[model samples]
Target: MNEFLAAGLVTALVAGFLGGGHCIGMCGGIVSALTFALPPSRRHPARIASLMLMYNLGRISSYTLAGTLVGGLGQLLVSNLQEVARILSWLAVIMLILMACYLGRWWQGLIRVEALGQHLWRYLEPLGRRLMPVTHPGQALLIGLIWGWLPCGLVYSMLILALSSGSALQGALLLLVFGLGTLPTLLLTGALARQVTSFFRQPLWRQASALLLLAFAFWQAMPLLGFARELPF
Candidate 1:
């Protein structure tokens, strides 16, 4: 991969990791519910691990699919209107900054942004419910595919970054890495929800993560503004 694509993927991963606190609050309940839905006999430690793995695979696949579509749109803009691509990149930087603010609790505006997806989610949620009390990993996978569409500000913020990606492949890769980054927190939550939540909830950690993301946003913005500098990969 080229330097720009490499950096984009790295930034996407960091954003997902740093946004763990938010993800916990947004999806923790659903994860817990899914875990409990497994039949008792299938709730063994190894079995639970398998189920969680399938669910996340399904969720991340959805993210990759979304990224592909948005990235294709971005590719079209870049092909036809280079200036528009630049403008969208700047907008993506702004969205990243806003994401940092939301992560740090400095502002809640992104919550309003999440409203954009609610209408679609309303339709998908019942289908997800139908797959509940999942007996097989396949069923869990299907449910997770649906659950990935649940509206969240963090996900939307990342989508903006995906859109800024110049090609469909890069956009899909960016989100794929992002989904992998989120896997740790979400996968572990079933076994260590309290501890993981407490760690991410600490003010020091949250602020530090927010600052890191903000710095990344600035780095991305600088290149767009003709202030490019070598970034350690």
Candidate 2:
């Protein structure tokens, strides 16, 4: 596998698990609203599950759109091998550091970077609000697409990983996978937020996940450091 691809996949899974803590803070109410939007006649377990799945589908679609855009951008930088890989490797290192910060409780400042996406999100906001009083699964799904534009540091980090992919399809898939990874927590916000949040807060788990991410970052950068290079499968 490409080192960049590996890093991106790892990022998606980690972000999915850890990134959700922030979702509960920012989007918990959205999840609740989505649930309530379901028809009371079929408010049983299956209907709720369907709504959750649709929300995730919409969210993942947004990630895919983002990945395609960034991945295409990456190709523009591909002509200079050393330069492009150097930047990408550095990006991986930065991602590791940010992950460490989130885990170590030392630097909460990373969240502020999400503001960079707020400009685009501002445009999407009105559309999302229009979908309010979500009465059908399709409306809920559309709302998720708009909601996917929500400013989030974790999503941005994953976007960086996608940009590092060096190919449009790969980059898009990377983001899609990352978005899918977060599905469990985001989908369950109404039911499992408390439990998942508590468990994720464990110091040991956070630290371990951080270290794992740091190691992956180092590995991804190894090619630029002369430690490795792309090899045939």
The top-ranked prediction according to lDDT is 1
Indicate the TM-score of model 1.
Answer: 0.95
lDDT of each: 0.86, 0.73
Q: Model 1, range 37-95, lDDT digits (tens) per residue? A: 76787678887787788888899999899888898899998899978888888888999
Q: Write the per-residue lDDT of candidate 2 for residues 32-108, one digit (tens) a residue.
A: 87767667886777676776777778878988998889888876777556478568757856876786676556678
Question: What local lDDT does model 2 show for residue 81?
Answer: 66
- Which residue segments of model 1 deviate by more than 4 Å? 39-41
Could you tell me the C-alpha RMSD of candidate 1 in Å? 1.4
